[model samples]
Structure formats: C-alpha cells, structure tokens
Target: MIKTNYHTHTTRCKHAVGSDEAYVLAAIEAGLDEIGFSDHAPWPKHPLEEHFIRMHMDEYNDYVQSVLRLKRQYANKIKIRLGLEAEYFEDRMEVLKKFIDETPLDYVVFGNHFHQLEINGRYYGRYQKTNQLLEHYEHDSIAGLKTGYYKIFAHPDLFVRSINQWDEDVANMSRRIIQCAKEMGVVLEYNLGGIRNFSHVDLAYPYDPFWDLVAEIGADVVIGVDAHDPEDFLDFDSIARAEKILEQKGINVLERLAF
Candidate 1:
C-alpha cells in the first residue's frame, strides 16, 4: 500500500480544514508512515493575492514552524516532512527559486494550476475548449519539469479537465508530458483528490488514458492523496480506486517516497 502522502495541505491554505497537528494525528490513525505538509506556496508579491487560493504571505512562516514542530513531536509515531504545492510561471522562475532556497522545505510538487500570469486570467478552476489553453498547459508543465526543482509532478494530466474528449491532440500532449517526466527523472503523481472533488463521470484528471501512456513510457509513479481536509488523509475509497487504475495500467506505484 502507499503509506506516504507528500501532497497534504493544511488550514493555512484557507480552503483546507483542520490544524497541522490534526492532519498528522489523522495520518497516524490512518497508519501512514510519512505525511508531508505541502500547503500552497505563498506569492505575496503577486498582484492576484485577492483572487489567490493559497495562504497569505504573512502566514507562510507560521505554517512552516507548525509543520517543523509536528515533525519533532511525532518523530516516534510517524515521519513528517514540510513541502509546498506550487504553480509554475515562466517569468516568475526566480521568485519560486528564491522561496524554495529560503524556505527549509523537504520538497516541492509542481502543480500547473495556471498557464501564466494574466490579469484576471482563466485558470484550471473553469473548463474551456480552446486549443491554446491546452498548448499552454503542455508547454508550462514541461517547462516546470525542466526546472528540476520539484521532485514530484502532481496531476500531470490536469489538462484533461478542460478537454472533454481524448482525441489525438490529447494523446500527443499526454505523450509529451510522459516523455518529459521520464527524461527529467521526475516522479509523476497519481492524484486521488480528483476522485473526491469531481464525480467519476465528470472527472478530468487521474484520467485512464494518461496513466496508460505512463505505463507504456515506463515512468516512475507515486500516489498522492492531495489531502486538503483532515478527513481526506484517511480517504480509503479514493486510494483504492487510484490503486485500481494504477494496477490496470500496469504502472508501478511506489509504496514509499525515497526523498
């Protein structure tokens, strides 16, 4: 079973529920060996703070300290690691690099939530049918992998959320992402959060075709709960479904993360 979840979020992210310790305690109850606190990275300088879904910049330090304290407190019960789930922007690479360098995080998972920084720009929150959006998603995702800053790539097939069908364009894009991940030596994550948020009928990610391509490419894969709520840490149904998909695809899902 996948015992380590590195994509956990906390109340600091605003959207998630429960305290940092609540997540840790729940992970322990769920029998998780390791849980990484990866709340949304703060972008204080960004102009979209009003529309941002992450924790405020002022709360960044408090988030880190809380995780660090839990790491020590739960040393005997479970392993805890501090991390961040961040979006990638080509022009803001230095800003991301500075945050990663300054913060004592164990890792950062690349979540390409937006294509670029445009005033009131459309992000993955809403679905659109434009091919340009698909291309931007592909380009930005590949660029994020090339940076080599993130150890794991979260929801590599998130572009499917906008795509209603798995056409040749979708397949080609999936191939590129899989190949890029293989070449960059990045671990691709099978996100279970999709199952919880979107119905199986409308779900765009954790898409089967994407993982089938991953199996063909022979890329390394990991399962992340993407836990935003405390109860999410113990979501067995989503985990089981994700595992079933991985099994059917013949993808190798790591039981534990090495780093």
Candidate 2:
C-alpha cells in the first residue's frame, strides 16, 4: 500500500542481511516508487554508549557509495534518497555536525537508543530492564527528540520497546513529546515495524503513543519498515495494520515515505 519507503539498512550495517541493489530491486518488485537508505551513523561507541548496533567505517562508506551509484543508475525508474539513522544526543550536536560534515547525506532521522539519554548522553537502541530504567531513558530521549531539525522521529513510541513504560508519568511524558513534535513541525513515524513484536516481549501497540499523538495534533505521519533485509521491503502488509490503527485515531493521510 506504500509507494515509497525511507528507512532500511544495507549490508553495510553488517547485522543487516541484504545487498544494496537487492533491497532496491525488491522495492521495485513490491511496486515501491521510492526508496531511501538510512544506515546507522558511525558513532564512537563507549561502554557508556550501549545499543550501538553499527558497522565498520569502510563498510559504511562503501555501502553509501554503492547505493548512491545504484540510485543514479536507476534514477529513471525510481527515486532514491541517502540518509542516516543518527542517534539523538543533544550534547553531541557538535559531534553530529562533524558527522554530517563527514558524510554526504540528504536527510537525517533521529532514533533514541541509548542508556543515559540526557541532552549530553548518547543513544544506541538497546532495551532497558525496569520501570526506573525506562523512565530514565525516556527522559533522555525526550530531550533528544525535541530537536527541530530532524525530518522525522523514527519511532515515536520508542519507550514501549527498550523500557516498556506505560504509567501515568510515562503517559504524561508521551503527551509532552507529542506536543513538542507538533510545535516543531517534526513528522511522527508510524513505525510500521511495531507489528513485528520484535522486542521478544508483549506490547499491545509498540508505537501507539506517537501515532495517537499524531492523530490528536493533526501532525504529519510517515511509515518506516525499519527493514534490515531484502524480504522486509514487502513490509507494507504490517504497516497496513499500523495504518488502520492510525486511521481509527483520525489521522487519515498516510504519506508515502522514501528514505
């Protein structure tokens, strides 16, 4: 049901399992008109910065070059976007600026996957253990998500994953996030991947709050397969489920997303 997709990983991520061309070709077969490559940005990982599922620098650069080449070669048929899944650590803004300078990028999406999550902390996309852990991380990511520069917040309801916080405080926190994003004009991600239950835990709606908030504020919504493999290009079926949920919430426009 989606003509475009903006989130996917190539073989460059190493943990991901697909060739750059294979991903694009699969999108074409799936009838996607646009595709965006948002590999994890290269970060200086430390013990303090867990959840860092990244790849080697050379592999990342090669992946970008390869995809850009493919994009140019295949431009007549489909649209291709080059971007990064940059972590949001506001304190690292300078570092991020350097990263942006280092890599040729078209757009950047923010994902808060870290332990400290404070303005000065880093994100790695790992899960936490308890309610306290969730609260702490959520606070940190909330700070990161406030940046007005990000084109889209990758998974608006990320707390459901790493921390699974669904208390009054968490709910209040989620609402504030919605408010901030709306004020800033940042697009909220439907995170079609929420349907997969990949957290190995039971969450009724992994990305519910973000979508719910999108509905409440009439904010723009984008879909992401968060695909790491070729087969995932067909993730529309899962996204359709999320789309239906969002429809029930009053946000009707499911804008096509290409990285």
Candidate 3:
C-alpha cells in the first residue's frame, strides 16, 4: 500500500487551502506514514505580479520554520519532510539553487508549470496552448531533471492537458522524459490532483498513454496526492485509481523515496 505523500501544499500558496497542522492531522486520520509539505517555492527576485500562485518570498523562512516545528512535534507519530514544488525558470536557477542550499529541505519536486521565455514580457503556462508549446515544456522539464536537484518529477505528462490527444510527437516526448528519468535516477509522480480536479473530463495528464510509454521505459514511479487542501490529504479514491493504473501499465510504483 502507498503509505507516504510528498506533494502536499498549504494556504501560503494562495491557490491551496488549509493550515500546516490540518494537513498533518488529516494525513494521520487517513493512515499515512509520512507527509511532506511541498508548497510552491517563491521566486524572491521575480516580479510581484508573478507571485500569483506561490507564497511571497518574504514568507519563505516562516514556511520552513512552521514545517520544521511540526516535524519535531510529530516525530514519533509520522515522518514529515520539508520540500517545495518548484518550477524551472531557465534564467533563475541560480536563485533557486541558493534557496535549496540554504534551506533544510528533504527534497524538491519539479512541477514545470511555466515554459521558459516570455511572450509579451511574461512567461506562458503549459496549459495555455496545445502541441505548439509542448517542445518548450519538454525542453524546460528535461533541463530541470538534469539539474539533479529534484527528487521527483511531478505530473510528468502534464502536457496532455493542453494537447488533449496522443500522437507521434506526444509519444516521443513521453519516451524522452521516461528515458531521462531512468538515466538521472529520479522518480516520476502519478499526481492525484488532476484526478480530483478534472475527474469529470479527460485530463491532459495522468494520461494512460503516457504511462504506457513509461512501462516500456521501465522508469521508477511514485504516487502523490498533490494535496492543495486538507480534504485532499484523504483522497483515497484517487490514490486507488492511480494504483490501478500503475498496476495495469506494469509500472514500478514505489511507496517511498530512499533519500
């Protein structure tokens, strides 16, 4: 059974809801052995307008302290890890590296929400277009994995949300990502957030076709709740669904990370 989740979030991210403690309590209630807080990492130098979905840079230290306090408090009850769901901004990697070097974090999961380069002086999100922007997504995501900074690649098939259909290009890109993860010794996440938010419709990610390629590549995989709310911490249905998919695909689903 999957006993750990490292893709949790808090209200500090602006888009997620619930306090740090609430998530822990919910995780315990749901019988999780470990829970990691991976709220969106702040880009301290990025323009204020760009901080829409993440916490402000000023709140970085406080977020760290909060999680650390909980880690100590619940040391015997459950394991807690400090982490960040980070983006790969090509020009700002040094800044991100600085944060990682200074912080006492267990891991960083790459969630390439934005493609590098600006259109109209602002970065574009992967969901904003179809196959046209897939190359950018593939390029930036691969770069982030190569950095060896991230332990898990979140939503490795997120491009499916925009592209909505599988073809030669999509299959090729999936193969490349799996191959890279295999080479880098990194694990890919089967995110449950997409299942929760887009359950009614066909999602671009958690795409079975993509995982079919993953099975062929024989890459390592893990399941993440990607919990934005405390309620999301107890989303067992989605977790079960993901497990079923992994089983069907013959993918190796790891219950926890080694490091």
Candidate 4:
C-alpha cells in the first residue's frame, strides 16, 4: 500500500521520457497519493559542454516552474513535490549546497551514480571486482548521509553491479552502508527503475544480498518508481512484486514519506 513515490524524473534529464504534466496525470490515474519530480540536478560549472544525464544550469528555472505549475494544476487529484536527484561530488558540494539553498526544492534524493563527478569519475555501476570502487562508493555514501541534505538514498546496492559474485567484502560493505543509513535515519529507496530498465542487463542492482542486510538491520525503506516515463507509474505488477518481496523479508515499506 505504498501510495507515494519521490524519485521521479522529467525529460529535462535528457534520458527520461514524457512531459512533466503527463507524469502527474499518470500518477493520478494510477492512484498515487503523492509524487515528487526529482529530475537529475545539473551541476554548475561542470567540465562537460553537454551531459545527457542531467539538465543544464540555464534550464533550472523552467524545470522548477513546470513542476510548480503541475503541482498547482493537480492539487485536487494528486500531491506533487519539487526535488532533484543529485550526487555528492566532494569538491563541488559547496556549489551544490548553494544551488539547493537558492532553489525551491522540497527535498533531494541521493543517487550515488558516479565516484564523484560524472565527467571524470568512474560510474559505480560499471566497476571492476575490486575494493577500491567499493571504498570510494562507501566513502561518498557515508559522507552524503552525514550531510543530512538527502532524504532518500536511491539504489544503495548500486555497487553490486560491478562484481559477478557477492563476497564477504561486499557483505561487509553492505553492512556499513545499511548501518549508516539506520544511524542517520535516511530512507533507502528500492528503485523500481532498476527492475524496469536494468533487470535484463548484466547489472545486479536491486540486489537481494544487499536488501537482506537492510531487512536484518531494520533500516528505513521506501520504493522509488524512478519514473523516467509517465507510464512507469502504471506498472502495478512490478510494484506489487516489489511490495510482496519487501514484506515477505519483514521489511516494512513506508506508506508515505514524512516530507
């Protein structure tokens, strides 16, 4: 009975599909009580001339206005909140903090996609079976949670995609991450986007071993549609399966985000 999702994306992210308004309509039709548009946040002064993963700094206002407009338009039908999915690049965190401070965002979800910056950093999902990547990922994750800026950690087991087999090191890494999230009281998102898009890929996210640790540790958990397209909200089959899995594991999914 999870009625809310806070990890939705908009077309501004470039890789995502559907209009902002269409997402609202789809969520309403699918019976979601609330939805948050957490499209990827564009970094200021990023080294790349063009990054397809996120919107440019210049487009920030239009993104905000569009979500705000939809929030108003769908007030009676559904609840819409404004947010951004951002990374914790240690060097550029000051800029990120400033951007968040000046914006009208309701919340921010932590997507530990890269080691640091997308331009020069390694993608966490495509790593070697080495401890270095895990070290970096663990470092970034803990540091980001310590900031208390991000409410939900999207795809916390994202590092599992790197290795072919799960081992003790991976288990210990999972424990540290799960324990940190529990200590900080941050929500760990079971991202549906992983199930929808990468289920067939070689990637191993939505990884069961990581979630088993989550269930054992009793960390806060939530399901993120991570909706790139509006129609993603209507995939009740995947949602049901995810809910049943978490529930069977004794993981109590949060029905609504306090935000």
Candidate 5:
C-alpha cells in the first residue's frame, strides 16, 4: 500500500468531478496514511477567460473546515492535510506569504503553467508554446523556490514542458533550481504524470530527462503519481514506474504519496 497522496483534487475545484468524502474513503481502502486536499486557487472570470478556474476562496475555506472536521471524526483513520496547489504568478511572493500566513496550510505545491503561449494569433498563457524559452518559468519558478514557502517544489523539471529540449541551457537552469531548492530543505518532486498523462513520445512536464541533474545534485526528492481523483489514489503501478525511472538514474528515496 502507498503511504499518502499529496496531489489530489476534488469536484469543488470545478474542473475535477468527485466528492471529497469519496476520495477520503478510497484512501482508507487504499491504506493511505495521509491525503492532502490541494485544490487549485480560483481564477477571476472574464468574457475572454472562460475555461480556467479553481475553487472559490470561501469554498476553499469551507473545504478546510470539512477536512478538519473529518480528521477529528476519522481520528485514527487517516491524516488529512490542508493545502493549495497554487500558481507561481509573476510578482506574487507577498501574496504567497499573505495566503500562508492567514490560512492554516500544511503545504503548498507550486507550478508555473501561467506562461503566455500564443495560440491562433492569441496567447494561451505566451511562448507561442512553440518551444521557445519562457522567462515566467525560468524566473518565477526559481523565485518561488527561493521564497521557502513550500514543503516540496511540486514539479522540478518543468523546463521541458515547452521546448522538449534537454540541452545546455536546460541543464544549466535545472541545476540552479535544484541547487537552490536543496539548500532550502525543500524536496524536489519527480512526478509520474508523464507516465500516466503523457506517453514516452510526448513532451511531458517534469520530463524524465531532468532526473539526471536532479540525481546528480543529490537533491532531496520524492515521487508522486500526481493523482487527481479517487481512482488514482495509492496507484502502486504508477508509483513503481516512477521508482524504476529514478532507480535507472541511481537516485532512490522512500517517498509517500500525499494529495
């Protein structure tokens, strides 16, 4: 049985559709020790912005309340952690500090998916997604790691997400980020979503190529299925595949899943 899942989502996040209680019950059957409810933060609505959203702040608070209540109700059953899978928006370190300071958070997982990528003459977040370099991720992600606000830097190898390249610049930047996060005691996460969501031929975020530098640097690390729904909780096959990949790199860790 897996220990925990630190990357789970609930139906309240809008994009995901499953009851929070259902996920918790599944974790019990899966023999998970902990589960982090890290729903995404809400994106403001606009006529142009129709597809992106997370959970309302009020609803998020209610979620925390419910989880807390369940933790007491379950007591010896499971350990539920309150967290947010937040975006590393450009120029939002203070917002990070404020959010954590005000909220009762066990941890925060940072991802830089907000880059502006042009699509059909418009932008999809803005690298044209054409494999060009992005300053948002290169700079913002590094900054977030430096802020010392997270327990784990969710996906350390997001560099190849846009370019699918693993050359000099890629290696250099990755080394810097891993080194910085390692110094801060923030473990870098080697995610298995690439195995589950993106095929071996696809350009996956936290690309497998990145494990080379991560292992080379001897950075503290963890493996997560990046599980979203109940069906994915404590999925040992994905976890085993992730471990095998890391083992090929000669990097090993006893990580428990927690979302």
Candidate 6:
C-alpha cells in the first residue's frame, strides 16, 4: 500500500487549490502516514515569468513557513514535509542549489516539465512530436537526476503527451531514462494527478509502455497523489486505479520514501 505522497501542490503555485492545513487533514483522514507539500518552486531572479504556474519569489518564505507550521502543528497526527516540485533549470541551478542549501526543505522532486527554461522553453506536454523534442526531454531528464538534488522524478514519461503514436524513439528513450533512474536510485513517480485530470486516452504519462519498461528494468517507483486540491487527496477511486494497475504490472512500488 502507498502510505506517503511527495508530489502535492499548494495555492501558491496558482494552479493548485486548498489551504495547506486542509491537505494535511485530508491525508490524515485518508489514513496516510506521511505527506510532502511540493508546490512549484520559484526561481531566484525570475519573479514574474512563470507566476501563473509557480509562486512568486516574494511568496517563497510564506510557502515554506506555512508547511513548517503545519509540520509542527500536526507532528503527531501525520508526518508532513516541506519540499518543492522544481524543474531543473540548468542555467539557474546554482541559484536553486544556494536556495536549497539555505532553506529547511526536506526534499525536492524534479519535474521535467519544460525543455530548458520555462521563461522561453517549450512545454513538453504541448510540443510537436519530433526526435529533437524527445532527445531534449531524454537529455534533461538524465541530467536533472544526476544533479543529486532531486529525490524523485515526477512524470518521467511526460514527453509522450505530445505524441500520437509510440515508436522506437519513444521506446529507447523510455528504456534509457528508466535505466538512468535505477542507477541513480531516484524514485520515479506514477502520478495520480495525470489519472485524475486526463482520461486514459488523453494523458500520456503513467503511460502504459513507459511503465512496462520500468517493470522490465526493475526500477522502483512511488505513487504520487500529485494533489492539486484537498478533495484530490480524497479521490480514492483514482488512487485505487493506480494501485491496481501498478500491481497488475508487477512494478516495485514503495510505500514510503527512503530519505
């Protein structure tokens, strides 16, 4: 059974909803042992570029404080952690490293969402299907995990959302990425948010072929609620669906994170 989720979000990200406390309460109600609030991380100098998807730099302190407060308040009820769902922006990684070094974050999940930078980078989910896109996605995914900063890789097969058909390129990319994560010991998430938001035919991630490759590679995985709302934590149907599918695939699903 999956008892912990580290891919949760917050209102600070602009795209997620629910009070920070509500998420904790819901998780507790749902019998979760631990939960990590990984709201979209903010860049140091780029304040307003992606405010629609992430929090502003000014709101960073409050976001951290909120999670810390919740962590303390509900210490006995549930294990709450402070974290960020960050994209590995190669150029400003130093800034991220400096910030992580300075903050009290418990973990950071690498969300390989964009090509290079969200400021002008292509959104992988909405890209035109091409080998170059797959190559960039593959390259960035591997490089980000090597950074040693991210504990989990969120939606590793997210690049497939743009493609209509699976081919050798997709299969090879999936195999290499899965093998890389296994070697790095980074946890790959089977994202429930994708299941909740998009139909089976619509969302490419939690992609069947990709997950099949994970099983074949013997890579370990964790099921992430990827909760955008408190109600999302209560969506037992989607959670069960993910659990059933993962079980059927004979995947190695971790009930809790190692670190």
Against the true structure, what is every candidate's RMSD?
A: 1.7, 3.6, 2.1, 1.7, 3.4, 1.7
Scored against the true structure, residue 251 in model 4 reaches a CA lDDT of 95
Q: Please report the TM-score between candidate 2 and the true structure.
A: 0.84
What ranges in model 3 sit over 4 Å off? 45-48, 117-131
Candidate 2 overall Cα lDDT vs. reference? Answer: 0.68
Query: lDDT of all the models against the reference?
Result: 0.82, 0.68, 0.84, 0.86, 0.67, 0.86
What stretches of model 1 exceed 4 Å from their correct place?
118-121, 125-129
Instruction: State how far residue 211 of model 3 sits from its true place (Å).
Output: 0.5
Compose the digit string of candidate 3's lDDT tens values, residues 127-156: 555545667777887898999999999988
Residues 181-216 of candidate 4 have per-residue lDDT tens digits of: 889888999989888877787547798878899999
lDDT per residue for candidate 2 within 63-120, as digits (tens), equals 6788789899999989998877776655556656765677677777776655534222
Residue 254 of model 3, lDDT score: 90
User: How big is the positional error of residue 231 in model 3, measured in Å on the Cα after superposition?
Assistant: 1.0
Candidate 4: stretches off by over 4 Å: 48-50, 128-131, 201-203
Question: Candidate 1 residues 125-211, lDDT tens each?
Answer: 453536576777888888899999888899887777777578898898889988999899889999888878774555477788888
lDDT string for model 6 (1-259, tens) is 5688998999988888888889999999888989999999887655535546888888999999999999999999999989999998888898679768999998899898877667544788877545578878888998998898988999888887877688897899889988998899899999998897775565477788889999999999999999999988889999999999999999999999866
Model 5 lDDT tens row, 1-259 = 3476777777776667667788888788888877777777554333444434466645766877877777787768888887777766544456557768987888887655554221222221224545445444667667777777777777666556566456787778778888888788777777766567665655565576677888898887776656566777656687777777778888756556343
Candidate 4 RMSD to the real structure: 1.7
Winner of 2 and 6 under TM-score: 6
- lDDT-wise, the better of 1 and 3 is 3
Residue 176, candidate 5: C-alpha displacement in angstroms: 1.1
The residue-level lDDT of candidate 2 at 39 comes to 82
